[model samples]
Target chain A: MSKNYSDLNLIVRSLLPENQETPISFLPEDHLQTDLFFRRNHFTYPSLTNSSYWLPIVGAVHTPILFSFKDLVQMPSHTVKVVLECAGNKRNLFKPKVFGEQWEKGALSMGRWKGVSLKTLLNVTGLKHDATEVVAEGYDYGNRTDIDHTFSYMRSLPIEKALHPDTIIAYAYNDKPIPFKHGFPLRLIVPQWYAMASVKWIKQIRIINKKFHGPFQSIDYVYYPQKESDAGAYPVTYNRVNSIIQQPLNREVLDTGLHIIKGIAWTGKGTISKVELSVDHGETWIRAVIDRPYNANYEWINWSYEWEISKKGEYTLMAKATDSFNRTQPPEAMWNRKGYGYNAIDTVVIKIE
Target chain B: MSKNYSDLNLIVRSLLPENQETPISFLPEDHLQTDLFFRRNHFTYPSLTNSSYWLPIVGAVHTPILFSFKDLVQMPSHTVKVVLECAGNKRNLFKPKVFGEQWEKGALSMGRWKGVSLKTLLNVTGLKHDATEVVAEGYDYGNRTDIDHTFSYMRSLPIEKALHPDTIIAYAYNDKPIPFKHGFPLRLIVPQWYAMASVKWIKQIRIINKKFHGPFQSIDYVYYPQKESDAGAYPVTYNRVNSIIQQPLNREVLDTGLHIIKGIAWTGKGTISKVELSVDHGETWIRAVIDRPYNANYEWINWSYEWEISKKGEYTLMAKATDSFNRTQPPEAMWNRKGYGYNAIDTVVIKIE
Candidate 1:
């Protein structure tokens, strides 16, 4: 196989930017292996040819300081299992199409991120009281086909989220130093938000007094109605409460018998409180058995249901998840211009012969 | 730049399938140059290493026959200027997101297609009276990421359209033999329909007496509601009355002076009858001067308006096209599952300083 060919069942969305979707069917248990993790790069992979990497913290800070990769990894380390989903994941499943990479349900993956809390770095830099947002800019830069100019992938976090203890300057994934594709030297891990909040390949960090109006911030990733102007647009944040059916792949054929319908559920604001499965196209719902010790705040929880079917025909399966924040995956996602946060009821059809 | 790189003003949507959008801004005169035309390929380009290319006509036909490429080209030929558009054109500009390629306005191009009328071919083959749809299967076949099985790019046209004199087995584009990327050997050029109806890389032509259920026919291009089932789905056809603003690109800066706002408009059912320009976000409208010789039924017509703006401020420009069938481009497109047939008012924002 060619080197560009990923053998781990990855779906290559675009070759130039190298965006790959994880095969979520294989991710039922532990955090996805580093190699199997989804890859989402806005531009070509940023070249890290520097002899030493230094993350500079500047702008609207009392004492701006640069942290070498050594300095970051040497700090008191912390680890958390966080689910990072691309804001545009499940885009193709939406009703009215929006402009973007038509991502599938697998444009997401979970990992154990280990690094120093972002709050620690902010405190060390002594952020000015006027600082409203902290911007993390990556080294990757290129011309996006949608727009006219070259762009560097940059996303800013509100002051409160940046100071949260769980938001980390992650330098490690799954107990090892982070792989290059997942942001090697250092990347931010905003636990409760969509993966866009976790800007990868940290190059520079800036604390700004006003809202950051960068393209990745002000133009793209914003939720707006189908209007001519940005009249009622807002930045995309938390992940929507969602569930995915893993087993009985769409149109799978099998003999009429007992089957275990397996899946995963997650939320950004809180833990998944409930997950329900409907084999009759949402006509009747059955609560799936969520795995025990389900107090995972930033981690996705696996769920399963047993079904005994005697009918020899086709059946439609749907899965819906409810989060502790009282948000439930909708039967149809609300239309947005950018096709973000598609948490519609997960569904698949199968046949029994 | 490498061999895969196209220096022409084209936007590469995907590399493997080689889908590129024509730089439509440069298309203001005669039919687009064959080299600059847009490309929409569902699979990799078929390798045509065969010493002799033959188009096989079979199924539900009294006289099934094979026509060599030379044989078809040598027959009495006809030429028509047709606007071929991807069904998903302007998809990203739609509201509530749908699945499939999030294409922009450039996913279309026009050219003078020269070929034998499909009616001539059907007459020679003697299609049976019961033949319902003519299925044109392309030589390209590959596994689509959205579906479970490998599929050949195939679509069916109702027998009425199949026998229409305007629908031709096109062998040449703009008087020259069709480019390899545009289907060199033979391609079906169905006028007054979206490019999906114009199957390229023609390999086999089958007359079937039943509704064709190929993946491209039944699954991908069908327009459906956001519901779970295909209960209200229908195949997409005909280009919606649409217009594109070719001047004053979005976010362009201009001096306070008189300017010619030029654009192009087209429709599938009839010739463009009227073109309107709205510089004040559709609050007020001005009729544009449609270029003369506007009776080209299958061709897009260019229109221009002389705008004298003395104000030093930002302006929003919008264009709408009205076809002879009384169909006018809507301010907002009606949403569908596949994001096909987006005919919303075209808008571009520019600053006059």
Candidate 2:
């Protein structure tokens, strides 16, 4: 099959600067520009133009159902302002540098996704009692170097994560039909884990008794600290507490005076409990004002720090975040072979002159 | 035509950490392992299994010559230890996060390249008086979205840069024949410019009387700031003064005592004049000891700082470099659409207990 690769360059070109802190900045008033949303696809985008689309449910279930997209839309729909980041976001920062698409911080984006809770969808299928895992498969298939067999993009989550209340089978993004590059007809949105767990262009869901061993699940997105050893490799999950400077951009030269440094902090595990800014490097940190309270568990919160620069020289600025669980952004992420989940404290060097 | 893409994953796996400062750290003793050397190829690697190889010299030359590799070897040869970094090495750190292969710090590697100086090679062919530019073309060709025509990978440099004494037509790396993925028969080594100017699998050199307009020369690698306009875009050139932390890895936990923080620093414009370290973020800085004298213009020198920590707390550490021209690493590199030449001071966070 001739597959059309998504124009990744266009996706990158459409992104607002990472310092902007909000993708909604580019959203137009009349329409939710689907193209502006950051997208990550494992395979070429599949062409689906049929008026009626069906999602197949297979594996450990007694009654496999082919639910139409129209049916999925009619099911109880919930909207979420979820922040989805490719597991490989900030992968380029890994010490040895990992393989896969070398995404920078732009691999993350926030979108208003409207869909039915995966739990509600699962209730229709009636999972077998022995099921321990649910494997979601996308229609796109391709040959990847890491695996010997050609396969479709597939990933699985433990039954618990799959059934989480926030996990959804998204039908629309930003109040519009999901764009083709972003899994058109249907896509799974795993709220807590990195985006890879959220299969795109989903065609099949298989509830299995044992753990899934698909290529994307076992070989590709794994975190192997000791490059060659798969023995210690584990599936990457959950977003780490992280923050990004949105204003007074990295090397932005500032007049020697008062300026407010602003940014956004987020975590998938819990609410952002505190954000600290260090303008004098890391020796001393001042608590930044979190602009908004943690209203949603999946969205980011904006924060700002006021600094009065009295000297004329270069300065290193840094930001660190701690989640409600006392999980703070580490100075360094554990070195993994795939360079996944790098949530080290963010630093920006700014000049005050 | 068949094209063999370099297994980038394998190359990344083969690289020692950037802190190691040398790619050959993992090499075996018996042979100079060229494959282990870090590689960055714009297109698929070309095959040149023929025993005899010829390099074509064209454009603006009165006597265009097809010099055989054998003839080139007879000329005076020089070996230089050069540290080559991708222009986009730290592109991931750029504020807006430009598109391309998001390279981390590992995009840089040091190598002993042996070959004849490009100036000496150019002397054989009489240059036309009006010649102002030299275009180098590699055998690899590919389809790129930015350009309309399918073309070979080509780039141009001003005649002055092309004739620099350090510029060479390299045939060997680490005293061994260049590997297939690393431009097997011959490659251009532009010492001062980022590695993109040092084209691999080189086949032809054209001395043009005017500026070159190839896709790579005019568009692909250009630094287009603001994303919307190319009017201010300029071809990327010259490596910026930069440094990296080699020890006390990011987020590394230290035992309450004395520890040595070490790293390497270099610049393409001039020798590294000073390296400063800030253990307490950026409040106060201490000059680090440059371990070696600045003996070579193209190689990096090691530096280290001593720290005595008695308290249990998290600390942010950063390193800044200044070059001989009194040019110091900026708090950030100028923002460009391609995200090239980011030379911000490097920082690492560590915890002490």
Candidate 3:
């Protein structure tokens, strides 16, 4: 407990890239990506596995070839804004029905993703005609079976999405190089999509002329439509519109004077068009003032509102958002079979004097 | 590098609370306050030294006594949500002229501050009627003769504000308890005020009838009002009405479709009454929907909007907020002598197809 701060820093530096320094001070209280909980379980594969990752291209539009680390560094680099959300996010809301990590909305973040376009990387290697799916593999230990299995982390995407110029085999973050825990060396960035597609510690990429199948791609990380139909299930693709209340959670409070309410919102397929706030349990709606332009496609937008209270009282507050396409944040929590994508309307209660 | 997930978990169990048994996966991200920068140069004074911290209470108050943790916790308990912000946040906005820590907005955070009321805490020991100023001391390394050479951290408040029921000697955070990195078992939490007043690693709480003097008490953490005389200086107190662009700093481009913009807004004194958004770079104003109640006095509120782009073009977006008292976010950053309390309007650029 009395360890030197420098010694702890040395341990962090030994495990991560020295070039990707964030002053350790930038990590906010709500920001937990650097907490020991997440860091403790990271890098086990890269630190212990003997097998290095490889980038292989075998698809319809690109040349088929196996690329090495030297080959990856040789590709042209491109940068884009992307937000990554863990598939198990908001799992705490599911309770008895859900089975996964109990992550509170902290499993997401926005960063300037930097790397070579996966499309370009594929084009460098020859592609087989008629390919439709692109598969990515990781070094995370997976048991191949459930009981004693290692965490299997792999997923595939349609060639169309994979071939997009913005989609990249990410190598850097915030303009600087990335730390290994954040998928150093190489990883994939599928903007506006779940993080499962952005495989970490990537070791291989395969393009298939036939449909690619995997547990993560099929049974897991998939978004089942609200109406489960006989037409077969649609895979979880683009992210849905969502927002989270950053204030008045459990430990924060407002002063007994004029104040403002604030939070973040975003969508995968469209832009956020409107965010409605209510103080009386969504009984009435007031338009909040938007603070910034819709800057990133995948990144959440910041927002706020002005309110006055002359006396002391207790009240419940709620916020719900809608996208440009007229899709509003669901008032009720949606029922996802896997309890994923819980972008329901968030609520908070406060007492003021 | 190839460590087992289970093995890594074991390490965590040893460092964090083991008796609480809050399931390995049920941990909340922001609950832990440990961070590398805060851990640096941690004070481990076994006995009194030159770098000693003091907590003085003055003003229309009673029960005035300078007591250590051994006495502070002996009083009753009270809990409230309080956010502490370093006066130097966003200082890089005015580089060179300022000589202080270059902290982003991350230095601020909300916590469930728990401790005895400064009033109650003082009453238990004793009080010298007629005190008006409550000064605090910190163990920052500095020269005793040179006021500027005082500790790197410190702040003071009016006695009334110091003894407000909402304010307390915080010893617990987010429930459970406080770690050494976050003021350990005792510290001050002056709701709605900046974090400087919430000195960490508290040592003594003294109650006196005269105004206290210290380098941190008079010279540092002072902010001058724009309308007030620049020659005169006043200690910075109440927080201002402000909001931040939490996402889409570099607007993302999605395939022609609906989109949503989101962000957070907050005020120091009361609930926010209105948040006005301008998509045309402040040229036009539109009301956004607020997501929560305006009652919380210290936490942030989430707000957002949606915009549809049928044609491709370049656009500028801006967000401005007004509080209950008609206090609005400034369109431009203010010219602060010390570059503190930056609540200027936030803007961003976006391209749509």
Candidate 4:
């Protein structure tokens, strides 16, 4: 781990295929610095690369384009401080247990990603009319228990999401070259979706005509609603409206006094309209004040409840976020066999002595 | 609704099939009186009958026997106070969502059950050596979305569980005949398991030579561990360790002062050794004082935390029951595709004004 990356107290979830979680409560920051961000890898790290690394855009396009890191940076740049949360970030919290990486709540991070807009690249590459999806393949490759043969970490986005201005071929993190641990030369940043759609280690891209059914799209990362059949299952896309209490970590002992309960809330559908905190178990909700400036699509909004307590005892804290779409988190998380999109009301118990 | 049952403030989950839940918080007694007990029915009420109802024990027995209510009452009497919770009591709280009744957390109540031990009846019938399971069929029959043919509510118990002394064919609630709304003539009380195994309004039972695969046994009460397939799934059996705070309703606001945090806790495999209260997200657990007088198997133990709060704001109250088997309630309910046995840590948010 780089000195810059390891010092942030990022908890290492796994080793072979590196997976690290940001100690979200430890970093008291609005947005993560590139070095303080979390890292998730599906396979062994790929060979490091410099800015001259070439990215090939192939298949179904009128003309394929080979853009080196230098060439991409030469184009007009766009920067977005977007939040990327792994679809399985809260898998461990689901009942009955779900398969794959057992992330708690921090396989998520926000960064000022600077890159060439994917639409700009698609325009330059001149995709054919039949193109339906943009597939990005990473340099890391390995075999998983779900599949037999070795395969690269790959994901695809629908034509519209791919062309959205917020979608970019990210090459810089916080105005600096992307860290080697986080897809060195270039990465595809598909905002408003789970980080899986933000394919890293950009080796090549494919403009495909069909709904891509690669392992990542067809078999894995698919949300199976019920247990017995796959008939109504769909690809795991878009982050559900979610929020978490970062202040006063669960079970933290506090004294009777004024305390600030703070956390972050986000959604893929629309801007977070408001966040509500419940010191009482969901009976009456007190609207939390959102730090309004960062209410953008694909970005998380910071929220805080200034709790001035006169009673010294145990308190349960529950946080729920509502999106501009008027959707509020449910008391219970939606049940999916795979444990994806868990947006239940976030709860924590605190003791005041 | 019977004045006896309705006066207790039962919430109607449905009308035609007659599913009613006890407003558990409203009752202060250790065990429910016959009039205050909850009622869960899967079909229209069967023809109500007075004593003289005949229960037939047939199949895989030396001699099938039919016993009348008088005959049952004449047998050596046994009385046990047991708690019966619907397997889907907390189904509404499961993630990804589940099917069947959208029950919250109140489809459970305890009562003084009086009846002849099922073993006593089976002993008279003399189960054949090949008997593998005992299938109980309720008189009520209905068509459901998953089944084409109208079928009687049926479930089975393995030979071992069927012969357990605690398993009784109850005909009396409290000291009187079972209420017509509950089961009337006969209700199988499979103590320690989800109420589903306690088939109500029982008409007959069959000692089967092989595993029972009735709709209720095979399709409904079975636990599907994952959404993909039913490979390692098993029948919903014993109730897992669970607890819930009752005194302070979720989000109930109160003044800062000395307050009692009261709740009930139970488990199937063993005694609820202790119920711990967590006010801090889960950082520190304080053992609760359980009323030892009723810590019987299949029975719930009432517990209380004497919390005196000096400062007020919001408090999250969490109750976790730990059984003598060394198992403690999990923070997350186990994942079951069908949403069975949800025993996650019970959390309630209370506000201290």
Candidate 5:
């Protein structure tokens, strides 16, 4: 699901110099790193923690089972390198004007998502054929919970993603139980898509024959294409091909000699196979060395290329990533009513004297 | 758009009495008046005052326009009646085995939304033509604000809505400037739709021609048909033919003779033309009298019907509304992946022994 500011008129009251339009690849270390909650337009983090957490299943499922923290702790865990890309990852790419966090590129991050397979847990509970959809609710309260809004933090995955052996109900990340900020006790981790599908602090897993329809499932995360036609209005999926020039974005120009063009590449579906760097405005493309492949699922891979600038006048650096599926980053992303899955290749310019 | 919670699995923490579903319709006196938010969900009301506020215009906009309380209050203002309805207003209707708020209607409300028109303000300032979408960000500081998430209160509307004449950049409600509890200083009051569009404590408005793709817009407010087509999905809009029987849901039995079946009917489009009551499931219908029409566009209108029940068994009283355009409520709503626009002819069971 994605977040869009539909009913708001923002006026910049006061912004620190840095909060202004200074571009970079990743979110600055000092800046706040928050989740992209659609219902809530601001970055929100969990302030409290439930000492115990679990993935409870009910409805058409065989027997209702609540997998507690202890049970999750005992389960076999695997670490998968995946990129948690907010559906609106590159919202900043749109030129002239755009609504949303000027999410230049940082919205997409590669992390070792640590969790247990949901397939394993459902198998342990005994699967039910009648279950057509698996409704998963999050631990976080809905944005306007205080306002009597009934929507809980929830969405449904077809039985397919639920049954995917790789789709894990993760309890740990980077070899440890995730910090409270990243869905500590238990989270459903689905690689290859945005972070929303990986419901954090998951408490319930409903197996239902009927399609799930609630606020979080129907309205919040879905995206409309820019074009009015049905062809463009597909629900966002698969991170698009996008790469960023990480090193310098009009930052202070320390003696510009042999500059190392460094950046990150990611795709929504498969592993990024190649990352090509372009200087002189896509006029020339040089193959950047791909870092070791992250897990086969949905995560980002780092890539870098060395540029020898004998004498630099002005340089525009761009990076494009190709996923295993062979989809390369488009120069201009497909226009969508909702700016989602924006994996267009990113370009950064540097003026060198 | 809206928030979808299909995937969420909430344990029945505490169950309301089965027969104690909140009445669907009630007098203004019965608008579920609550001085404080329910504690079950720990959420605080956002500070709407300008001293505690800031608005930033980030993407695609000609120039990012940031505002403080001083700036917003400084802009021009207008008055309009906006009826805000949470997407989950009739969530409780998904009975039998539905997992949601189980809201017995009542989630809808009409209020004077006051705000400055973003387009007017931007036009005065000159937004770029490329700016097609507007993201309205809010200052809703919730428990989960620290994660790398998007803002808590956010929604994206097409620039069309932002520029509409009726759309206002509001700083007041009902001639009085807002109180902190009610989006102080300013809030966006979008006419003709549910209240979710009236984002409270708004902070920033980003403009971009590109789609404002985020979890909220894509996954949340979107509706999918029961059938998946090769094409794409549909967007949920307008309140459908909906009404609630104001009094005597399950508590007391009406004495035989004359009783008033009072309720309210509303739609996203035109005015309420006729409200009919059905005493026998839907076998027969009678016209119910509307008290008076709300002058604003399509805000909810109050209505009541006098029924002389000479004889009664298990009386199933139903009500349906027709709009000014002659759109009538259907007996059954079209089935979709998300149960949106469920304006099906309502059935209210009343017994007179």
Candidate 6:
């Protein structure tokens, strides 16, 4: 049975229900439940058959290659633990609140993905010198108010991001076949960018001589700064620094005494350098102990701080993260028309009795 | 009519309302309106008589002196514009929401004060070599739950801060007699610390032989870091870095066009080195234009950023300030039980339609 997209009541809906949010508190575990991984689809699931399928490669190439699923897996396969977050995560917190799924930091999840490296596939197909962009298109089609006609979900990446060794065309998740709701037989995973860049139900790869101007590429997912014309807007790329408080949820009443505060921090640009906590409404901050043994370049790090509370009153708990590149989460998330990349400091209020 | 203390539903009310908030947007001006200046009192306003009144100078002094107001103004009065902010400003933003007035950035103001330097008064009284702290007492009296017995509002400062040239006993505000509500006749002004350190309606000054242990000084306004017991909390001092966006208040809707975003930035530690704006949800940031001619070592500097909006959508505007000492506003304010010294980056969201 097909699900009605209207039933989801998502903040942003073009093709499929923007469902799937990971229960982040269960993290620090080696593998996330396959059902709990975030799923962002641009179209309804396409019907599948036992017949073999091929991925077509066209444009700016000396010779285009149409490789079957068997052909991709025959080449050396690589496995990686990657975390994916919707660009619009935490969009509900924006003042005046932007449009899209009003996600409150749950639109993210981690998975152990098994895939064939894009670089390996690129090495097999000879590319022309002028090929500057790699356009990836999905088979799903949908109507978008931002564009004129029904179009398939498609996006393009620069040659550098496309050729990155970590970029992959995946066939399995958590050592199992990719779930039908998540993309079925195949999907593209661009580890660093927002989940939107990792096209789902991917069908064709086209190498272009110049920047691609698809609606999703040019008009949508672009950064329109205040007063700047849309023509000059920059395309959204890497994720910013962000952190979340997992223990003692907001407004949780507790006894006036010592308590342990904990949370997780992550960023797409670099490793988290430090995490800090503020228990007295941002009057003074102290460093939190980050669990370093399980830290990974792409996975979130767990951190904790012990706080002693003798006074019975309300307290606002806050967490901030700084990346190795000296980039820190902003006190407030930057605002974009599409609500992309909202990574402000995380806050939660609780009462002590 | 005397107002009963119970009538005031204040977050931090004991002997007095503990109420005072500067109208921040009217700042950077040469003189703030007398009515708009923040007024924090620890007790009911004490009626003043024209008959000879003296400010008693006692404790660790070779010769105790009772100098009248006339004697203070006679010592070459100096006038300066200094900004005073309640240390607990923006305390409401902390997660768990700590106690004290849930101030949202309006507990500060600038005033042109006419007074005699504390150093001049100290020189006349002849401080003993053992004198290490100067405790200032206000005439207003009240009961206390934090301590035993009815105590006058009193706070002590280290000799260094007490003897600083900027520290003064002010006789007038804005070239006029100080209003009754705002410490009429005379008040102590400690230029750099939070308003609580500046005792209001002053009547006595006592130089101590050692560190003072008054309720307000050693207990109330102290910093208690995560691991520290209440007994080990540090006394609150010097204000932290802070900024505010006065124009285009949060959630303001405007037409899609060019608009100038303006605000004020100030720090007690040093001059503002830079101010940056992020309109793309902090994915990228650019330097804002700081109004330079009005810049003063002790006053806030006005800043403006030109934003051109061509897209009709929601946007979150953020501002981050850095000081000459390399201290930047944290992504989240530090938290203290008293909710003091919140200096997180300022953020606002608006819709362009």
TM-score of each: 0.54, 0.51, 0.50, 0.50, 0.45, 0.50
Task: Pick out the ten consecutive residues of candidate 1 chain B with the lowest summed lDDT.
Answer: B1-10
lDDT of 3 by residue, A1-353 (tens): 34232222111111211111121211232332332212212224454254554666554644567777666667787888766766656655653344333355655666777788888877667556677888887766444322333554667888899889988988777766666677767778898887677887777787777776676777666655443442445677777788776654421233466767777777888788878898788899888776555465666777788778766555678889888889888876666655678888877666563
- Candidate 5 Cα misplacement greater than 4 A, ranges: A1-50, A143-148, A227-232, A250-256, A293-297, B1-353
Those runs of model 6 whose alpha carbons end farther than 4 Å from true positions after fitting are A1-353, B1-20, B23-31, B293-295
Show pairs that collide, candidate 1.
Answer: A96-B96, A96-B97, A96-B98, A97-B97, A97-B98, A98-B97
Best by lDDT: 1
Off by over 4 Å in 2: A1-33, B1-353
Tens digits of per-residue lDDT, candidate 5, A229-318, equal: 445344555456677776654222323467777876766766778898887889999899977652445655667887777564557777
lDDT tens string, model 6, B1-353? Answer: 22122211111211134354543542333436565565555556665665677899999888899998889878978776777888777876776466555566667777778899988888998999999999998888875544447888889999998998989899999889887777878889888688888788898999998878877787678876542357546778888878898656565556666898888888886788899988866668889898853546767777898999899777878888898899998888877666778888888777766
**How well does model 1 score by local distance difference test?**
0.82
Put down candidate 4 lDDT per residue, A1-353, tens digits, no spaces. Answer: 11121223454454445666665654555656565567777777777545367889999899898988778989999999888898888776887665455577887898889999999999998989999989999998886644457998888888998999989999898888888778777889988898889988888999999877778888878889886688789889988999888876664545567999999999987899999999977778899998876337667888898999877666789999999999998898877876788889998776664
Q: All models, DockQ values? A: 0.03, 0.02, 0.02, 0.01, 0.01, 0.01
- Considering summed lDDT, which 10 consecutive residues are worst modelled in model 2 chain A? A13-22
Clashes of each: 6, 9, 90, 33, 126, 31
TM-score of chain A of each: 0.95, 0.89, 0.81, 0.94, 0.81, 0.91
**Interface RMSD (Å), every candidate:** 11.6, 16.3, 16.8, 27.4, 24.5, 17.6
What does candidate 3's lDDT look like per residue over B1-353, in tens digits? 33122211111101111101111111122333333112212123323343433354433445445555556556678887655555655553552234333333444454567787876766665455666666554443433322223354545567788778887877777776666556665667787776667776555555445665555666566775442355667776777777655444333323345667666667778767778888778788998778764346776566778866566555677778778878999876665655677777866565553
Q: Lowest summed-lDDT stretch of 10 residues in model 6 chain B?
A: B6-15
Q: Going through the candidates in order, what is chain B's TM-score? A: 0.95, 0.89, 0.76, 0.94, 0.80, 0.90
Q: Residue-wise lDDT of candidate 1 within A1-353, one digit each (tens)?
A: 12212322455455446666776764537655676677788777888999889999999999889999899878898888888999989987766555466677888888789999989988898988789999999988987544667888999999999999999999889888889888988999998898988999999999999978888888788888664566778889988899899876664555577999999999988788899999998999999999944449888888999999988776899999998888999988977877888898999877665
Query: Relative to the unseen true structure, what is the C-alpha lDDT of residue A38 in candidate 6, on a scale of 0 to 100?
Result: 53
lDDT of 2 by residue, B102-153 (tens): 4556577777788888888788898889989988899888655444468898
Per-residue error at B138 for model 1, in Å? 6.8
